[model samples]
Every structure is written in structure tokens, then in C-alpha cells.
Target: MSTIKLLVTGSTPVTVTTQKVLVARLGDEQSSHLLTFVAGGRSIIVKQTAVRTGTVVVVVSGSPGLIDAELRKAVAKAMVIRSTGR
Candidate 1:
């Protein structure tokens, strides 16, 4: 588990500075994992699973667009880095 400050940009720009971000692999299945974070008094869950075509399926919950685009991007990038062990 690690903490990262993420800037969420939308109609109004806000920054989330905390240590509540959690990243973890969900199962033995490759490419399956989970990401949990806090935003707007809600818990956000981003789950990624391996598809048949060697691609990943990402499902985000909690609030639609509440995490914002920038935060999503940051989370995706971080997930990639974790998966690649970089």
C-alpha cells in the first residue's frame, strides 16, 4: 500500500492529498487486481481483470466522474507500474 497525492480536474479543480490509496492484486489470475481510494466522502473501487484477448477490463465505481479524468489517469498509470513491477 502506498499513498499518492492526485489532482482531480473537472468543473472545479481539487487536489486529494492523503495516504488512503490501496493497490492490490485480487487473485491468482494474472492481470486481476483492485484499486481503492477515497474521494468526495466516498470509497472508489477500480477493478481490473484479464480478458481473453490479453487485454484488461477496468471497472470503476463509487461516483461517476467524481474521481475526475486526471485522477483516473494517475491511477491507471500507477496500476501499470505495479503490474510491471517497475
Candidate 2:
């Protein structure tokens, strides 16, 4: 099995930050696990988890623009593998 990266865009800009914080907080409460990174001008957050499949699921729970941008990105990513030989 390999690590599967999943990005869950929250309902709002604050939500995204909050969720990430929450995840970190909970993780801290337990043990050190997983990794998170923030990137892009929109402040997109990337979360990596160990999974068996290559499917990347993006949960939308943020501002419309942010959510839309994520959806577009997801579609574009998914399309690439389908559109080209990968």
C-alpha cells in the first residue's frame, strides 16, 4: 500500500484553517501521524494519508469560490489520467 493524498476543502476559508487545526490538535492529543501542507495563492491545503487506492477525494465545505476552484482542480487532475496514458 502507498500513501494517498486527500484534500478536503472546508465550507469557508476559516473552516479550512479550522479543520486543519482540529486535525492537528486531535493528532497531537494522540500520536504524531500524517502530514499537512499549504500551497498556492488560494491557500489550498493538502493532506496525505495511507490508502490502497489512487482515488483522491476532496470534501467541499468552504466558500463558493474556494470550493469551485478545488472542484475544478480535482476534475482537471482526474481528467489528466483519463485523457492521457498514465
Candidate 3:
């Protein structure tokens, strides 16, 4: 799996541990995937598109540390979903 190294574009280092959550919704009419994170005590959601067959969506919700680790986990879960032809 690849890593997401977000670099700062401005001066002065800004350190923040963002929490992320993965969600997968499948219904008879439509399917959707989402990645939600927390910043400043607020919840941020990142919707995923272009999902193909056998794609898995995982949800990681918790503190920054937990979310950080779950990011990798989400990818791994996705791979598994693909393998299972879900």
C-alpha cells in the first residue's frame, strides 16, 4: 500500500493529527463510499467515487492517532473487498 504524506505549503510547521473514518453504503438503487475525519472538533467527510466491482469501504472513527492508523487499514480493507468480488 502507498502512504499519504501531506506536506506543508506555508512557513511555520503545523502539526495536526487528523482522524479519519471510512464508510461504505450499498443499496439496491445506489452505492456510496465515504471517508470522514475530524478537525477542530468538527467532522469532515470525504466522499469516494469511481468505485469498481469488489471494492470495499471501511470506516475509521476516533482520535487522530486512531484515524491515522485506520487510513492504512482502509486501503487494506479495500483490497480485501476487491479480492472477494464484493
Tens-digit lDDT track for model 3 on 11-75?
43333342323333331122234445443456455443322334344443444454444555565
Best by lDDT: 1
lDDT tens readout by residue for model 2, 6-81: 4557533222332222222211121112232333434544432211113433233444445434544554565476
- The candidate with the higher TM-score, 1 or 3, is 1
Error of 3 at 25 (Å): 21
Q: Candidate 1 local accuracy as lDDT?
A: 0.45
Clashes (N, CA, C under 3 Å) per candidate: 0, 5, 4
Error of 3 at 3 (Å): 32
lDDT of 2: 0.36
Q: TM-score of each candidate?
A: 0.33, 0.23, 0.29
C-alpha RMSD by candidate, in order: 11.6, 14.1, 12.1
**Positional deviation of 73 in candidate 1, in angstroms?**
27
- Better model by lDDT: candidate 2 vs candidate 3: 3
Q: Report lDDT (Cα) of residue 55, candidate 1.
A: 47
Ranking by lDDT: 1, 3, 2
